[model samples]
Target: MKDLLLVLPRLARMIGSLLGDREVPLSAKVALGAVALYLASPIDLIPDFIPFVGYLDDLLLAAIVVDGLLNYVDRSLLLKYWPGGAASLDTAAAVARRLAGWVPSPIKARIFGGRRHTA
Candidate 1:
């Protein structure tokens, strides 16, 4: 819980940067927006009233969005808008990966598709 409290602000800043970045693709922005909406909506896969488990879905969805955006967007562009240093970025990525691990492979594949390669 303490760890999550620390990371959430940084993640929020990163999301803001991504949304403001002109170089980021529309699709990525749209995906992020959807995630935000999902978080804000009263309805959820797991209702917010359920204590710790309630928030898990929101965190998982955020991790999925961040991971997918990292894969889809140019690393250079992402780095450009990232307010944090390389170490911070790496930490954020690691956190996202850890959260994503809780999700099944099939669901990840369905949401993110196959691995994307940059030219």
Candidate 2:
């Protein structure tokens, strides 16, 4: 958990970098922005004040977005903007994928806009 927390800033930086990159699909950009806004918004599927499950909804949503990015975004481009070791991002992506595994691949594809750049 501490390690995950430590990587949050790096993840934020990577997301910001990707957002500025023109190659990212419009769908991905919209999904990313919407998820970020949802995360920051006071309203949530589950309130954050609860003990253990308080953040479950946020975590699930983030995992879904991360899964979409990993599936549709270019691996090389993602690495380029990542602020940490590739292994770290790979591990995090893997974890997100697992957390979001229940979601269908078609949904993930739609979220990332089917890799519009296609490379």
Candidate 3:
């Protein structure tokens, strides 16, 4: 859990960098934007008042978005903007994978166009 917490900031920085990079495709930017919007919005798939499960949904959605983004964007470009070391990036990816695992495949297909996106 501590390790996962540590990686979240690095993941945020990477997403920020990707959003600003001209090389990143508009589709990816839009997808990232949607994720951000979803996070900030009060209405969630699960209401925030629901305790642990509510926040779990948010984390799962974030992980899914991160994993999906990695599929469309080039790794080299992501590496360029990453402020943390390669190991940190790997750690973030690991966290994403673990969280994403909890999500059902049908939902993933709906979000990622029927393809299983892996980071």
Candidate 4:
């Protein structure tokens, strides 16, 4: 608990930086906007002042947004700015695979290059 408390400021700064960065994908920007709005709201889906479980909703929502945004962004772009975000690309790929489900090989190839898969 103490450890998390110590790290919360740093995490907030990172999220702020990501939100302010112009190079982040449109989807990422949108997700960040949602997060910002949620944080600013006086009423939340689950209030943070409660016990440990109070944060679960926020954590899960953040995860889903980050995962979805990452799917639309190139790994290189995230790597260039948020170094840790690069590592999350694999998780994003898995999420994309789950969400997009078997993109046509030809369309995938066309979008990504000569030969490639969406995930």
- Largest TM-score belongs to which candidate? 2
Give residue 93's lDDT in candidate 2 (0 to 100).
87
Which 10-residue window of candidate 3 scores lowest in summed lDDT?
Answer: 110-119
TM-score of every model? 0.82, 0.87, 0.83, 0.52
Instruction: Identify the runs in model 1 with alpha carbons over 4 angstroms from their true place.
Output: 1-3, 104-119
lDDT of 4 by residue, 6-51 (tens): 4345445555666676665445666668766886777778888889
The candidate scoring highest on lDDT is: 2
Q: Model 4 TM-score?
A: 0.52
CA RMSD per model (angstroms): 2.3, 1.8, 3.1, 8.5
Off by over 4 Å in 4: 1-23, 84-119
**Global CA lDDT of candidate 4, please?**
0.52
1 against 3, candidate with superior lDDT: 1
- Candidate 1 yields a Cα-based lDDT of 0.77
lDDT of 4 at 44: 74
Query: How would you order the candidates by lDDT, starting with the best?
Result: 2, 1, 3, 4
Taking the candidates one at a time, how many backbone clashes does each contain? Answer: 0, 0, 0, 0
Residue pairs with backbone atoms closer than 3 Å in model 1 (clashes): none
